[model samples]
Target: MNRYMWIIVALSISPLSAIALSPEEKGLEIAKEMNRRDDGFGDFTATLEMTLKNKQGEESVRVVRNRTLEVPEDGDKSLIIFENPKVVKGTAFLSFTHKVENDDQWLFLPALKRVKRISSSNKSGSFMGSEFAYEDITSQEVEKYSYRWLRDEDYEGKPAYVVELDPVDPKSGYTRQLVWYDQKEYIPLKVDYYDRKNDLLKTLRYEGYRQYAEKHWRADRMTMINHQTGKETLLNWKEYRFKTGLSDSDFNKNSLKRAR
Candidate 1:
């Protein structure tokens, strides 16, 4: 009789424990989950490969190294190192974000021994030759965009929640974004970007997910395809370590000038 009672208790709690969540609920939950550690401060290392195809059916490849560190209430601090080929080897670019003003960016030239400031408009442009624009490399600020539940669906054989986001800031690079999140894990499966004219500009697909830590799932591989430019960028996470004890001073404007 006690065994039978235990079975009933398990059945009662199962349904309540795995309640199906709404789309917005899933997206927000996953966003919050990814940032749950170190107060959103950590270090990530990845190999970024950019493939640019021209209308003439020619393609060029550029390999890069990407590192990012984020701190709460502060914008994303990042460094992108160019590691391939003889000419651009050891070249590094850094960006320091501001609380109110625009981000300060700089590029260190190995031959020139000088760091040049990056203009705002160029930041929205491509990084190296990849389809992933420079704007996409920085960490996304959740509050800058408002979210709404779109629908529930199945993605890659897993339950998914679809949500749409409208950029609250007028100066945002993109007007709207649609995200698909895994229902079970709360990880983003796919995201769509729409331009200011409300047209689909690019489609980004996330794959090769691996657990970075407890309750934290990181996408190890991402492919970004540019429909307009016929180019693509593939990002492979070589090393993604969390809670590295990175300080704010490591991400200041002075660091940008000394990037390489």
Candidate 2:
């Protein structure tokens, strides 16, 4: 009698444990969960030092300040101001990312004294000659790509889920990206970018992750390596401050020109 009751109990729970989601459904679920975890940080400001290195190992450094406002329904807005390296000082880049539309971006060239709009066609171009593309700097909305759960693997001694994402934009420079997202944090620790030709193009590594606001997980350093060019770019982030009461007016194209 005891064995029969145990079998019935096991049968009841078996159905729940055996439930499985399709690959597409599983991928979308993971992406949505990651996005949810990162949401609710109203705004943030940080200082970044960008280091560009050439094939011959020559290095150039530039300092910039970044401010971003979170927009839950769509995407985030950001303003980036070049602060040092007198040649490019006071130059700013403003971006408004959308959930299902092309992102709006503007570049303020202090030398030319003009704020120029960045067309969608140029979104794949290098950002400030760094390895990072203009689109790469924008907030990555879940709607921008179609995802598939690839597999589970160990990355840097951490258990991670491998996800493949294909960009929805026809003109995107990358054909697809494979990301290793840490299971615990749901944040990507490494990303492999492939060119339009379906050739390996670049690899981006996220490092030095630290939690902010006791909930938000942020990487303090990121490195991008261009495989074809043998060039690299490193970004070091510092002084992250959140919820500074930023508004839409602070992210407009006009604000780019006024950015100090």
Candidate 3:
């Protein structure tokens, strides 16, 4: 009966062993799992309606089209073109994100007939007079932040994992972000961004997530609210088409001029 007792003891300890991971390790594991679940969409195209609301409740809207290409060895590449609004029409932005290095970005102005490079120092600034900063528009790689698992809690009636992400980039505008990841899908439901002064700056919420290709999840709408300025940006995405056979040639700086 000694062997039987040993087996029982082993089973009891296994559960405890699984729960003994340090906060950092557990946080990293969660981030990696989330990244793994989203690994294989070759490319996608979508239409976006961006609404900017000021503190006085005045609103302005812009129509944009977005194309993204996945890079297995590095971060993704994306190009965004403005489609509507007489003022911003024919404007385009291109970004090449890297896992370890600063991202390369450029903006093409149709009126000016020039392409302006976006410097790393200016990434934290506003994007197109919206609440979203330029850096916030880039794909967030798993390696870009250090994470700590805060706790498990209920968020909006669903069980969620609360995790704190400290930006690895020194130039980041946020000191830390508290993220609420849906426990079931491993997708982010909400995030609270703290500014460099460690004060609450903005809150972003994802809504109406729908699965694509039976494996990938995308949010239909995202709202970002700036507490400091009382300004908000709403991104409404539609017509998501995945695996559109996009290539690197479609995401270069030169392509920005031809985006329209």
lDDT tens per residue, model 3, 1-260: 69999998788665235657789977887898898889998899999999999989999998999999999989999999998787788999888899989888888988888999977567689887899997787888999999999999999999999999999989999999999999999999999999999999999999999999888999999999999999999999999999998999999877888897
lDDT of 2 at 79: 94
Q: Rank candidates by TM-score, best first.
A: 3, 2, 1
**Tens-digit lDDT track for model 1 on 88-156?**
887888887644456778788878777788775454576676677756766665665677778889988
Better of 2 and 3 by lDDT: 3
Instruction: Highest TM-score: give the candidate number.
Output: 3
Against the unseen true structure, what C-alpha lDDT does each candidate score? 0.70, 0.89, 0.90
**Candidate 3 — which pairs collide?**
none
Q: Which residue pairs show backbone clashes in model 2?
A: none
Task: Supply every candidate's count of residue pairs whose N, Cα or C atoms clash at under 3 angstroms.
Answer: 0, 0, 0
Candidate 2: residue 260 lDDT (0-100): 79
Estimate candidate 2's alpha-carbon lDDT, on a 0 to 1 scale: 0.89
State TM-scores per candidate: 0.76, 0.90, 0.91
